[model samples]
Target: MDNWEEVHEKWTSFQNLDPSLKKELDHLAGDKKKLEDAFYKELTFGTGGLRGVLGPGINRMNIYTVRKAVNGLAQYLKENTVNVYDRGVAISYDSRYMSQEFALETAKVLGAYGIRSYVFDELHPTPALSFAVRNLGTAAGVMITASHNPPEYNGFKVYNEDGGQITPAEASEIITFIQQTENELTVPYLERSELDNKELLNWIGEEIDNAYLEELAQISRLDDDGIKREKDLPIVFTPLHGTALELVTKGLRQLNFTNVDVVKEQAAPDPEFSTVDSPNPEEHQAFTMAIEEGKKSNADVLIGTDPDADRLGVAAKDDAGKYRVLTGNQLGSLLLDYILSHSDKAILTNGRLIKTIVTSELGRKIAAKYGVETIDTLTGFKFIGEKIRQFDATGETFVFGYEESYGYLISSFARDKDAVQAAILACEMAYYWNKQGKTLHDALHDLFEKHGFYLEGMSSLTLKGKEGSEKIAAIMESIRKEPLAEIAGLKVLEVEDYLSGERTFPENGSVEKIKLPNENVVKYKLDNDCWVCLRPSGTEPKIKCYFGVCSSSNQESVETLESLKTEMENVMNQV
Candidate 1:
């Protein structure tokens, strides 16, 4: 069906649509661009799951779309899962506008299909939901969060029975079911009272939180004594007005960290995320309040977790007494070093550091120094989680996994990035180093000095709506048509085209199949371990470019990173 036809069907035929959505439809009636933007295409049920701006229309994230997705999940589970009713599904949501409503709708839709749902009593972090799936022994899990996206956005993430994000194969099957549910309004759904009467809905609370925190405590390098030793370490944290406040604070307390501070203004769950332009911890704007709190408290370090608490951001005071936000690569590398350096290397015979292709090589280099191997997956943490599952079955140890987008996973138990776990370890690292009269800044500097300065940078071009998406597609195709031979004077020795499913060398023209699953990404490998990557964001309407370089001095790495980023942006713009 054409886009306008879908809009007309929703606008004229779907009478039972929510009043607010109906109002939005009326509001957009006069604007063809807005109408087309909202109806041009269905919001993709990607490998992770559904995510989009919350509004009216078939394409927006609303009850109809949520129900359709859930109903499809129900259908998929009914066919694939054994004893599906008894196995059940876990449901969770962060503190976003309509998050609870969407989660409730998910349970209702599943209930109509006779699928049991274990939902949280209140908002919780994404990691807890990942843990809940395994802890409850459910068939699957759904996390309703847009992660670090702007206020207008909300999302749904599906996790497998293994407690990790759904694999590509599983997602593909579920997506087929979703696409077959043509009209969103036709998806089977039950009311809340009906769900309760059917005994298909269960509410989860601190039991899940406690279990998740205990796992974090176990994987931590610190014991009670170590936590006590570092209890007096001054740290500031902000949840960016999302669902992380209670659990992260409780986790810190459980570890006996005494001097932890929460940024008062951003501590509560504010769906609007009113304080910041975008709630992404990767951006400096999100750290404004945390920085102020850090300065006033004379904090040794500052940490901020995005809404849903999957990704973490850290800042530490430099010599000028100003807080410098560490890039995801820098912090991830620091954490990787901290975890490996303080460990018993004898137990690491099968240990591996799993990271995404876009992640910094500093980790690979760091792992080499400690005699550990690093595995590079595609850009998503889901890929990292897949590696963990694979290694587990293969009798290998999953040491640590991270992405440069401020996501990290310490223990494989959760199967996704756990900001709470990373926060605990960051606090511990700060305390341990602080006792030796070093701040996190000093520790980071020490790493750079010991293992050459490694710098990384990311740039995003946001172009919303259908036209923007087409342009993004155009840019990606252009990059493929004319591959970069060099980045900032460094020769591009190899190209890893995930979409093409091949890794080719420029000099020899040798080709090898990429073992990782196909994704719409192309990476250029340069001499001196420098490289540039170009890919469209999976969850947002933006093109992302990542640049990484390693050098002996900070200036060299900084200069190289700037040059690489500048040159790549020029390439992208030309496209």
Candidate 2:
């Protein structure tokens, strides 16, 4: 078992498997590097569940790995529930390679365990899956999407009955089960028709779609005058060859936006995503075509979504008449300000805003102005979803939630982030601004002025393969061993070591407890309102360094951030 020959033997035992499965394995046969990469480890099922390159290997995403995950989940459900089949699981998929097949395979596996499953009839957005889980009173849910990754990648996101990603404690239990059931080849899967005949499989479609849309409509605060006055404001949208085209466009039209233009080339779901280099909406390149079309049509805004429509990206015309893509922080700030400013007075009485710890502080400032309380969670939309559920269970009002990574949620109906809702709101906000003789950029600048210049940036250091993994681990260890007393000419006031669950204030020589769960992250707070945080990405092979800086002037903030980024890079490289 030391060399790849043992691995090949283990792989060859599946020769009698499905043709597609065998073909994928055959393509990687006898290639040492490919074999090692595919078998180096099992695809991890953590708090975020599994994500990997889509192919045939134990370490890769394939039928066997998926079945193993489902088997573990099935066992967990059976042990936790009194009525296994009655507490069904909701399943949905996006427009990625073999996403439908994976979704079906998952459903079939759950059916073999005598678990009822409700699956979307066609490709749908991730948020819809989250919503369906809670709406149907299911025990769990699964979404088959990579969420802005390239076509070569696919992922499985697991959710609990509350419509939130599995918490760390729950994920630990599932991971233990998956590890105990090591022989994935022995996992059971019934035929699709067999499950259908047994009444264990349900296909959900427009009925749920309409219900979800109706709930979304309830959150719309657009007035008749505003809609009428700005109905003709030109806007361009691109789904980046994903699942949101029809739903987002339909939502826009339903809200009385008559001049919204869809990028025809990327309007349809294409697995290859031929038009863009990567399907991620965060990158400027993903919106190249849409921006061009917007310019040609003299549109006021250009918006794009990734394959699953959970995250949204927007570009607005600046005072210089040039289009500038707004970062996730900027977009969230604008949305928060707009929603709070325009919301009914009744909802604001007990309203609360939730954001991840890494998100910009500008959101908190805006929320303060409106008497809205803001809470910080760990860096994931799941944490936001968890907060929403907690509030609902306790009868507290949920107002808005967002992460720094282009994800936002407005309504509790969809527990996860909803780009469909964000798209509709963005358009309405644009309309509101248009009627005020201003643009989104102008509005953002005014907000920046009100709340001192709050700037944020993120840098990622990518390390691939097994060696790269070791290197990243070493870097984190080094940082922990040699603590920083100062960074970017500012004295480090405190260091929050999430892994140790302790916060140390050097100035006061005192320590405090952080109530959050333990994680492999560290944050340093400077004398000024600037901070730096470092953590390994949960789903990708990269170490992310996040920066937040505040100053009286925009130029000063930008310069300070650049200096901090340069210093951090230099320190990391030396390690």
Candidate 3:
């Protein structure tokens, strides 16, 4: 079948395998299925780069695998990038297990090629790495993180000179060079001593951090009149045992929020993520510790960030005095409304609000209220970053960009989703509303009252390992084969099959081309302006179903969302 056995033999017999890794390989001696799954193929490296379980196999995220990927990037940059050595790559890592090791190994691989790399001394946010690329005028950047994945998982993401994730075309070229790397263990790299002697590996920290924070301070300040509005407002933050503690705390303090508190349990970087079952901020479970801290301190608001701090989750006390976690869409809507209502007219002129296709329509309506046009990109924040670059070229202001996955971008300083900037601004907004005797919950209600209650949610089925991958493919294929006409009595007006790059309108029997890049996704524009979309996760082994509904009242939106979700489940179950 494949060369898995051949690959396995090479890995096991390698002379200089890490001793711990060798032991792990030895433990797999009598396990055929585990071996097959681990060595069936090299880890998939797409636009998102490499992500997989941590272990010794070629398909896992071990030192050799990391080296192989870095070597491929080295080869690609040497060929395609201008001033390859002079315009070095910026590298940063998160709090995941072996993340620092992977970050150092990345520098060493590039060092072997005589390519310079500026490495952060400690763990940094993904967006900071993106900012460092442009700040240092580097040819590319690398961030070693799995985002919100489980403890045993780790990943590497690539960025272009524009400080955005590598575009699809660029990814295709890098994948070609990566495939050219035949032997993982044989890939050459400079040792730490060699790296130091060559002066190719450089350490970077505080200066870049200050630069990033200073840029954020320029925009995160909402009230400039030196007005006193609960400046000591109690705020609770938790990094969820990730990398956000230093930057986020400094950011809040910079905003003059003196009473900010950190959940002591999640204040330190934890590889095992001992505090929460899942490290993702989007989940309510991740807020347990932060909410507990909020209750003890009578905090006005709570903010929780994922491991890498690219995503932010928020909660605020409602009239009932209990904290309620805000959905990504709800928080996004609040941010949009606050920015538009407070910003000067000239800055708002020709402003653009960019959102992913799956984001709630409520933000669109909010932007329209301010006369700002809302544009939809694909699901990834990179697409939004690309739009920011495009708009800059055309002399339009990049107002704000966000997605439904708890990631938001305020300014163009950091091209990727920036939770640091968002946290500062969100805390300021919360404190400002608090002075008026209202919580963020009240601000959200004011938005809902004006722009109809928009409820959006996602459900994913986790299918792990190779079998899960196959099942995800089969499910998508089945949906394409037999398109749906209705879901729970709701009529489907149009079906968008992104794989085919075509949109079919069932009512008119017509088709149109979708302008976005090709992805394996399907969407339905149903009657009553409701919509549903399904796509296999690019970075995780899951198929996600996104549902959205807008109604005159909160109760109506909730009921319709439940109906839509149940009907979609029934439809997929049939498939």
Alpha-carbon TM-score of each model against the true structure: 0.98, 0.97, 0.98
List, residue by residue over 1-575, the lDDT tens digit for candidate 3.
35889888988888898999999989999899999899998899978699999998988999988998999899999998899898899999999999999999999999999999999999999989999999999999999999999999999999999999988888999999888888889899989999899899899979999998888778754656543333788999999999988889887777777898999999999999998999998989999988888989999999999999999999999889999999999999989888888888788779999999899999999999898999989899989988898986798888899999999998888899999888988998897798789999998898889888889988888888899998889889989998989886689999999889999999889999999889999999887779999999999989999999888999988888999899887766666
lDDT of each: 0.88, 0.88, 0.90
Error of 3 at 159 (Å): 0.9
Mind giving the per-residue lDDT tens digits that candidate 2 earns over 78-151? 88756768879999999999899989999999999889999999999998898898788899999999888878
**Tens-place lDDT digits, model 1, residues 80-142:** 988879889999999899999999999998998888999999999999999998898999999
The residue pairs that clash in candidate 3, if any, are none
Predicted structure with the largest lDDT when compared to the true one: 3
Q: What lDDT would candidate 1 get against the real structure?
A: 0.88
